[model samples]
Target: MTELGFTLKVFRQIGMMKPILPHKMLGAGLQLVKWGPGFPSGVNAAAKRFPRQLAIIDDAGELTWSEFAAQINQLTQALKDRGIEAGDSVALLCRNHRYMLIAMIAIMQAGGRVLLLNTMASRSQLGELAKRENASLVIVDQEFLEVAGDVDQDKVILAWADDDAPAGLPSVAAISADQPTKGHSKPARNGQVVIFTSGTTGLPKGARREEPADLKPLVSFFGAIPYRGNATIVLAAPLFHSWGLINFGFGLSLAPTYVLRRRFEPTRVIKDIEEQKADALVVVPLMMQRMVDADPEVIKKADVSSLKITASSGSALAGELANHYMDTFTDSVYNFYGATETGWVTIASPTDLREAPGTAGVPPFRTTVRILDAEGKEVPRGETGVIHVGNDMPFGGYTDGNTKAFSDGLMSTGDLGHFDENGRLFVSGRDDDMIISGGENVFPRELEDALIDHPDVADVVVTGIDDDKFGQVLAAYVVVKDGKSLTEDDIKTYAKEHVARFAVPGKTMFLDELPRNPTGKVMKRELPEFE
Candidate 1:
C-alpha cells in the first residue's frame, strides 16, 4: 500500500479504536508527517475527487478543477521551457485574479519558490524586494507592469487577463500534454514561500520560509472548525497578503468555490455575498468597520444565511465590532492571530469570540504558546509578556542575518499577550509600542479602542510623548468626522468615561487624515512628534 493509503488506514483504525483520542492522535501524526509537503498529493487527491467542481471565480472569469489543473500543468511546462527550475524564486505582483492563482500553482508544481508581493507596492519597494529575494523571473499582471519598470523587462513574463491572450508571449496552453505533468514534482521539504514582514518596526524584513509541515496543523484545525468543503469563500483582502494567500491555499486544499474582488467595497461586499451565495469571508478589522458603517438596510436586505464563518485578523477586532458582526451575519465570527512568519498560531472560534469578546483565541492544534519575559523565561499565567510559538511546523528565518527572532525552539512573535484562566490568549499590543507613563505600562490599543467608540471621533491614534515629570505622557491624534467639532478636553472626557484614567490621552491634535499603509494599518512612526 502507498504511504498515504497506509496513513489513512492507520487513521481509520485509530478512529475506531479510540474515539476520544482520535483527534489528538491524528493531529500528532499529521505533524510528524510534515503534512504541507504533501500538498501536491492533496491536490491530486482533490482533482480525482472533484474533477469538475468550480475552483476560482472573478469578474474576468472562472475555472473548474480540471481547467485549473490543466492551466497549472501548461504553466509548469512553459516555465520549465524558459529554464526555470526547482528552488528558484518567482516573484508575483498581481491583483486577485484567476491568472494569479494559476501562476502560483504552476510555480509550486515546477518546484520553484514563490515570493508574494503586495500589488500596491511602489516601484521602489518592489525593486528592493526583488533585489533582496534575488528573484530570477517576475510574473506580473498587465496592470502592475509599470511597477516592474525598474526591473529588466526581458526577465519578466507579463500575463494578460483579457480573452485574447497576448501574442508573442509563451502560452501555458501550448505546452505538451505529457510535458512535466502536475503533481509529479517532489514535495518542498524546505519553505515554499518567503513572506515579508509588515514593517511595523522599520523597513520590512523578509520572514522565514514557510514549510509544508507548518500547514498540516492548519488543515487539522480547519477540519475541526465549521468550514464546509463546498463553502463559497469571498476574498475581500489583497491576495498578496498572508491572509489572502492562506485563504487561497485553504480553498484549493478543501475544494471550495472561491470568489475574488479586485478591491474591498463595503456595499459591494454585501452585494457580492448575496449574489454569489458566499458562505464565508476573510477580512481585516478596517473592512469590517466600513461594512458596518454602510447603509444598515443593505445588510438587512442582503441574505447572508449561507455564511457559516467570518475570520478577522491583521489587527485586533474590537469586542463591539465582533458582536455587531455576529448579530448582523447571525453566524459565528472568528479572530485569528499569527504573523507572516507563522501561518496560523492561534484562532478563536465563534464560540470563543462570543464568550470572550477581545481575546485572540487559543493556540491551534499541535501548537504551544509561551508568554515569555525579556530574558526568555516563561511568565506566570495572566502576566502580559512577549508571545512565543513552538511547533513542528515549517518556518524559515529572515533572509537578513537576524536569527535572534528564534530562540530555544520558539519563534518570538514580538506580541504581548497573557493567557486567562480559561487558556484564551489576549494580545495586549506590541511590546515596542507600549508606553510608560509615570512608571506605569500603557497599551495604545486599549486607549485607541476606547477613543474610537466616541461618536465625534472618526479615527484616532494614541502615542506616547516625552514628559518632564511623568517620563512619558499620552498624546492623541484625531481625525474627526465631517462637521463634528471637538476639543482635547471633550475627547479626554469621553475616553475617561470609557477607559482607565492613565489610559486617557493627555494631548489631542486634530488632523485632516492619518497616514496609513495600503492595508489600512496606521503608520504610527510617521506621526508628528510633539515636544
Candidate 2:
C-alpha cells in the first residue's frame, strides 16, 4: 500500500476508537519508539496516562494500570537479576490469568523473548517443545508442576501459585516481592513473541512474530470492530492462542479493562459478561456454541446488553452457530477470518452473517484476499481455490526456518475458499483437507454446514478416512442435541438429502462432544479412526 493509502487507513482505524487526548497519543508514540509494539509498551503508556484506571480483572482480583505496570517492572528486575537479557528464550506454560499475561510483559521488559506454550498440550509435548525450541527458562503455573518437572527445577519460575512454591522453587510473586520497584530500562530491540500452531498432522510448528507487530492487523481490527478506547473487554479465550493473544496485545493498546477467567464454563461466561458490563467480548466459535447451548433461563436472567461487540475467531463460525448467536445476542457478533500466519483477513459483520450465512465477510482496511488456483493464478470470484492473503504483517517464518507458500506478494492461508459476487469471502476447509473419493472431490465444510442446520445435530465434523475401495471416504463425528436421538442411517439419509451421495460420510460416530483444542478447532489427530 502507498503512504497515502496507509495514512488514510490508520486515520479510519483511529477514528473508530473512543477519542484520546493529544498528549496521550504523543505519550503512546514515545512508548512505541522506546519499547516498540506490544503489551509492555502499551502497559507502560497506560500506567502514565490512566494510572488509576482498572487494567485487569481476573478470578484472583483487580489491578489498576499503575499497579499492573509496577508488578511487571518488578518482575523484570527479578528476571534481569537472574541474568536474562535480550534474545534469551523463556517459555511460558500457564493458563489464562493476570500473572501469565504479566509474565509475558516482564519477560520482554527483561529482554527475554516470550514463547507461549498451550495449556492443552500434553506435559511431555510441552517439555519436548520447549527443549526443541531451545528455551533456557520456563515460567509456569502451580497446576503445571508436572509439566515444569520435565525441565530443570532450577530454571523454572512459577507464574501463578496456589500457595508457596513447591520445594522452595522461585515464583514470580516471590522474586518480584523482594525486587526493587522501579521502571525497567528499554531493551535495545523489542523482544520477539513466539506462538506455536496447533497442527493437525504432526507436532506443532513454532511461528515467531517479532515485536511491534505490523500495524496493519491493528488497523484491520479496530477499523471494522468498534472496540472503544478504555472500554471493558471480557476475554474468555485462552491467552496462548493467537486470537486470544491478539486481544491482549493489540487490545491492550486500547488500554481496556480486560476480564479473564481461569476456565471457560459457558454459563459462567454469561455471568462474567453481565457482571463486568463488558463493552467487548472475545471468544472462539466453540465458546459461542456452548454459550448458546447454555440453559435459556440463565441467559435470560443475565444482563449482557452492554456488549457492543463480540469478536470471534480461531475457528470457523458455522452458519447455524453465527445466526443463532446473533439472534440471541441481538446482532453483536463479528466473525474474523485469518490464520496465525496472517492476522485479520476478513470480518463478517452481523449483516454479513444474516445476508450470507457462513460467509467470511470482506477484507478490512488495507488488507487483500485472493482466490488463486494451484499455479498461483487468481480464480474467479465464485470458484474454490487456495485462499491467499496480503497484509502489513503476515507470519515472519517458522522457527524451523521454513516459510509458507507465497505468490505475488500474498501468502497462502492453506485454506480453500472463494468470494461471492458481492465480494464476501467464504472459507471452505483446509487446502490439504479437500478429499477426492471415487474421483469425486468433496469439501467437508459443505456437508458440515448442511448437517448443522438440522435441529437435532448440535455439532459435527467430517473427515476423510482411508478406504480400500475408494482410497478415501468421508467420516463424520457428530454431537447430537440434548434429548435427541440421531442414528447412523438417520445421519447418512440426512446427508444424502443435503449433499451428493459421494460426499456423504461412509461412517458416522456419535459423541457427547468433539475433541477440540482450547481455540475450538477440532483436533483431527485425536478423532477416533473410522471402523
Candidate 3:
C-alpha cells in the first residue's frame, strides 16, 4: 500500500474505533504527540479526557486516571530534581502494578531512557545487564533489591513495597514527597524503550525500539480486534515483553480500566474476570493453556461471560491449544504473530482459528509476508521457505549494534513457513530446527502437533539428535495426563499412524512438566539431552 493508502486506512479505522469520538480524533492524536508518539503522551491525553475514570486496578489497590497523572507529574519533578536529565538511562525492574507504570511514565517525562528488565532473570544476569546498559539509576521493587548489584544505594529507588521506605535508599514515596510542579517538558528526542529478547536461543540481547513513523500498528490492531471504550481488561502478560508493551500502549486511547496482578494464576485470573467483569484478556499462549487446563468446576462457577477477546502473542498458539480454548470459551480467542524486533505481522481471529487450526493467518492491512528460498527468490505459494515480513513498523536494531537478516526490503523472521491455498500463513518451525533424517527433511512441529492432540498427551516437545544410522533422529519429550500411563512403543506407534515414518521419534521420555520462561515459551535449550 502507498503512503496515502495507509493514511486513509488509519483514518477509516479511527472512525470505526469505539472509544475515539470522531470529533475528538484529531485532538486525541495531537495529544499523543504532545510529549512524543510513545507512552507518556497517550497517558497524558487519557487523563485529560477521563480524569476521574478508573485507570488501574491491581492487587494492592485502585487508582483513577487523575491520580495516576498526578503521581506521574510529581515523580517526574522528583527525578528531574535528582539530576536525571536527557540521555541518562534508567533500568526498571518491577512487576505489573500502578507504581511500575508511574515510575515508567515519570522516567520518560524526566528524559531518561528505559531498559525493561526480565523479571525472571537471575541476580548475576541483572547485574551484568545494568552495567552493560550503562544505567545511571535502577528502580527496583523491594523483592528484587538484592538483584540490583553494586549500584550505590543512593542510585537505587524502591517501588511496590508495603513497608516504609528503607533507610538512605529513596522510595518513590519519599522522592516525590515535595510534589514539585515542574518537569512537564518533553525532551529533544523521545528516549528509546529497550526490551530484552526472551533469550530462549542464547543469552538475552537488548532490542532497542524506534517510535513508529505511523499509527498503522495501532490502527491495524483495532481493525482486527473489538476493543471498547471504558472496558475492563485483565493484563496477565508481563509488561516488560514487547507483546504486552504494544498492547498496553494501544489501549490507553480507549481509557480502559487495567486490572493487573504481579503474578499470574489461572484461578486468580478467572476470579478477576468475574469480579471485575473484564471484557478482554491479554496473555501469552501458556496463560491461555493454563486457563483451559483449570478445574472444570471452578470454570463453571465463574461468570466469565463478559470476556469478548482473548489476545495471545509472544509464542506459537498450538493447533490443539487453540481448539481447546475456543471449545471451552466459545470463540473468543485471537492469536497475534510477530517478533519482538518486528512489530505485529498477522492476526488470527476466531474465524481464522475455526477455519485453519494452526495458521498464523494473513497479514493485516498494509503489511506483507512472503516466503523466500535460500537464494532469496520468492517461492511459490504452498512451498516451504524462510518467512520474511514487511510492515509499517520496522525493527531499528539490537542494542549491541547487530541486526537481523533482511531480504528484498523485509526483515527475516527466522522461521520457516508457507502459505496455504486459502492464503493463511502456517509457521512450521524455526528454520534451524529442521531435522534431516536419512536425507529426508522434516519439521518437528508436525509431530508435536499430532501428539498434542492425543487424549492422554498433556504436552510435548520434539527435537533432533545425531544418530549413527540416520543422520539425525527425532526425540520426543512428553507430559502425560494425570491417571494415565503410556510406554515408548505406544508413542512411537501413534507417531507412525499419524505422521510419516521418518518423523517418528527414536525414543520417548515423559516429564512431569516442561520448562518454560515467564512468557510461556518452551525452553528448548533446557530440555535434557537425549542419549
Write down the lDDT that model 2 would get: 0.83
Report model 3's TM-score to 2 decimal places: 0.94
Give the candidates in order of TM-score, highest first. 2, 3, 1
Error of 3 at 36 (Å): 3.4
After aligning candidate 2 to the native by TM-score, how far in Å is the CA of 200 from where it should be?
6.6
Task: List the candidate 2 regions with Cα displacement exceeding 4 Å.
Answer: 1-27, 164-167, 199-202, 467-471
Ten consecutive residues with minimal summed lDDT in candidate 3?
Answer: 11-20
lDDT of 3 by residue, 1-531 (tens): 775676455545443344545445565566676775667877877776777889999978898887888888999888888888887889888899888888888888777788888887667777777788888888988888887766766678988776654677788867887796433877766767889865654457998877776566676777677677777989999998988888788888677899999999999999999999998999999898888999899988888889988989988886579879878875788889998887877788989988889999889877888899999999999999999999877577888999999998989999999999999999999999998998999888999989988889888888888999998998999999999988999999899999999999988899999988888878888899875
lDDT, candidate 2, residue 162?
83
Write down the lDDT of every candidate, Cα atoms only. Answer: 0.71, 0.83, 0.83
Q: What is the C-alpha lDDT profile of model 2 across 40-118, one tens digit per residue? A: 8889888767789999898889999989999998888888888888889999988888899888998888777798888
Residue 242 CA displacement from its true place in model 1, Å: 1.8
Candidate 3: where are CA atoms >4 Å away?
1-30, 164-166, 181-183, 200-203
What would the per-residue lDDT of candidate 1 be over residues 1-531, giving only the tens digit for each residue? Answer: 553554344334223223334554454344334334433434444455556877778776777766776667777777877777878888887777777776776777667788877655677777777877788888887667678887767677765444565566443344434565444444453326666655544446666555454344544446334566566788877777877776666555456778886667899888878888887887887888788778889988988787777877776675367877777776567777887776666888888878887888888656889999989899999999999997555666667866537658788888899999999999988888888888889988888878887777777878888778788778889999888999988988888898887888878899998886545678787787775
Point out the higher-scoring one by lDDT: 1 or 2: 2
Q: Which RMSD values do the candidates have, in order?
A: 5.6, 2.4, 2.6
